[model samples]
Target: MIESWVINDDSPVPVSSAGVVEALRSRIDSGQLETWLTSSSGRLLAFVTNAERAMVVLLEGEGGPGEHAVDPGAAGSSDGFVLSNGQGDEYPDEDTVPIREAFRLVEHIVGTGSWPADARWVVDR
Candidate 1:
């Protein structure tokens, strides 16, 4: 199980189901744009957003492949969506989901320490 989560590289806090959900909600509601959840086991879930669209990336271990939740039917003419931090990072529009979905994904990973099988994922090679 996940022992704790760090928000935006801040000091770590004990992980609780409600805490995780509230953190995500507060981030979105406040338009923080960039927040990261790091598990005690070294797993990292990076959340970046443009307010309406968000990306949740799951990294399993040190140098392990990263998996991203994707919206299978989302189509766009542009190359990808940009999620700006210091230097901007881009993810395919299809790889971005609604903020609510991001909340669900983060909650599942934090609560169970595993990915939810219901969503489509693109794994890094």
Candidate 2:
């Protein structure tokens, strides 16, 4: 597992739910996250189960119904996080960084309002 002090110091970035859902859908369809995030401007947020079998990403699209809700149709691995834009899609963990690490990175990016291609991860608190 990876932990970073930055994650603790940073708060989640608010984003548009529609945009985040669409981006995740693309990730599922193309089996890539980084490529999809290229145009996303870092407005996305993700949550993963400890088992890493399931996760949910949200767009801080304020005051919208189901902004954080996933459509029933767009789903991921039964052993992986499920996301469907009401369209068929899946995840490729081969390119998926650790979920918590991704979470921290995002928190830092959003909190600082700066995007870093790579971040330092550590195991020690």
Candidate 3:
């Protein structure tokens, strides 16, 4: 699963990519963020919402990131429909790189840092 983190600070800290990885680790361990992976389907999803700003950042499981603005109250449905699309949305522009690539990058990044707990960790040998 590709874990998601939202940078809400108007002035984010200047840090190397390695520092970014560490920050993700901290958030994951603290339960501030969570990851969802579909083991059977090889899918990853991330959704970070800013209620105050009525913005939803949907990473769409990986290329870079996509941002959508909606009424905070309507954010749920707006975001859900986008992710549900099998192909992707035209609004984000077809030229944009596919999000699946981003998922692969996140998997690579996490594989270097830590292993996710196996979905079936206690299986009998």
Candidate 4:
């Protein structure tokens, strides 16, 4: 299970399910462009946008290929929606899931130390 998480690369801190949810909400409601969450071990990471979308990435270890969450339908649609990484970097909407969906994905990792199987994912080349 995930013992701690770092927000936007800050010092790692112990985390609870409720705390996670609260942080996400606070970031979104505050109109922040984005917020990042990374596990203490650095295996799990997530980037959430103010638009209520998030992209989660899982790393096997150093030099290992990373897997990122994907929404197949959204990815294929021509909605022109985009997500930003809060650093002037932008990505296609297909690379992220709604924040509502993110809660489950993050909670799963916190509880099982694994990404949920139900969501679609694409591995970094």
TM-score leader: 1
Candidate 3 per-residue lDDT, tens place, 1-125, comes to 43323333312333233454454345434533332222112223332211111112333334543332222222222221122223322222211222333333344433432223331111111
In the order shown, the candidates' Cα RMSDs to the true structure are 2.8, 14.7, 14.8, 3.6
Tell me the TM-score of model 3. Answer: 0.25
Could you tally the backbone clashes for each prediction?
0, 9, 4, 0
**Error of model 1, residue 66, in angstroms:** 0.9
Best by lDDT: 1
Clashes in model 2: which pairs? 15-60, 15-61, 53-80, 53-81, 54-81, 55-81, 74-83, 74-84, 76-82
Worst 10 residues of 4 by lDDT: 76-85
For model 4, state the Cα shift of residue 98 in Å.
1.9
lDDT of 2 at 100: 48
Score each candidate by Cα lDDT.
0.72, 0.35, 0.30, 0.64
Local accuracy of candidate 2 as per-residue lDDT tens digits, 2-116 = 2211111123443332244343344545643222121133233444332333333333322222122122333334343433223323454432345545544445543453334
Model 1 misplacement above 4 A? 1-3, 77-84, 88-90
Per-residue C-alpha lDDT of model 4 across residues 12-120, encoded as one tens digit per residue: 6756655776776666666664555666676656555535566667666556678888877675322222344334444567887776787778767665677788978
Comparing 1 with 2 on lDDT, the higher-scoring candidate is 1
- Give the per-residue Cα lDDT of candidate 4 at 115: 76
Give the TM-score comparing model 1 with the true structure, all chains together: 0.79
